[model samples]
Target: WVDAPNLASRILSMTQKRIAHDWMHCYQYAPVLIETFVETPRFPGTCYKAANWTWLGTTKGVGRLGNSHKPTLPQKNIWVYPLKKRFRQILCSNVQ
Candidate 1:
């Protein structure tokens, strides 16, 4: 349920209570690993990050074809950490 930025905050807050009760309770701590399926260019995840979520990695490019094989849909990307970990890593990769 990736919502637009404008809608994320409102939706998160609105669902906080229930989320904490229903979802959060699943683990002892408030859950640290947060994975999501991101295929669409438009997704509202900042709000989730702010709430303490982690992004893993993104899916491969588009579908692929092979001999007598069906093409597969693009994988769902995963963004971890409230700070967009993957992006930061790329930015700092060349730093000394």
Candidate 2:
């Protein structure tokens, strides 16, 4: 876990650089966005917020195999990081 102040921003910057320079080349495609979840009650997603990630919402307390009518897991907060400035436009575009 990162404890140092402002370290999350540095780490996020390095990760984005690596993804653009290395991962994109290897995968042959640039990702528009990245998403992650933080377990609520245990974490407040402070690092993700510090790194400029958006808090989309919270997930329903349902596991992958569980039914929506009966949630069987802890709810988590959803966070997203958009790589592109026009990520929403790119994601919604139908051009291939």
Candidate 3:
């Protein structure tokens, strides 16, 4: 479960390598970015940091179906990893 120290980093590195190599070869389109959220109260997001993921910020503590005015869930930390060097440009480009 990658609960051990330093194990998260190893697993993440292997996963990223596989995604860049094996997965990309299998798919026609490659992913530009990967994102994940960590529950603030339960996790400090240390693994993500170790794996070089950027910490965007914390969520508003509102669930998808909950009212924005009243948060019904715990706030989570937003993390993102850019797989491509031009991920920002690609994401911002309007190519419809």
Q: Pick the candidate with the highest lDDT.
A: 3
Sorting all predicted structures by lDDT, with the top scorer first, yields 3, 2, 1
- C-alpha-based local distance difference test score of model 2: 0.85
Show pairs that collide, candidate 3.
none
Backbone atom clashes (below 3 Å) for every candidate: 7, 0, 0
- What ranking emerges by TM-score with the best candidate at the front? 2, 3, 1
For candidate 3, what is the lDDT?
A: 0.87
lDDT tens string, model 2, 1-96? 856867778888788767755756898888888889999979999989988899999988888876566767788999999888999899989867
Q: In candidate 1, what are the lDDT values of residues 3-41, reduced to their tens digit?
A: 476576566556543443555467644422234566645
Q: Which stretches of candidate 2 lie over 4 Å from their true place?
A: 1-4
lDDT of each: 0.54, 0.85, 0.87
Task: Give the total clashing residue pairs for model 3.
Answer: 0
Give residue 91's error in model 1 in angstroms: 28
Worst 10 residues of 2 by lDDT: 16-25
Q: Residue 48 deviation, candidate 1, in Å? A: 5.0
The window of 10 residues in a row where model 1 has the poorest summed lDDT is 27-36
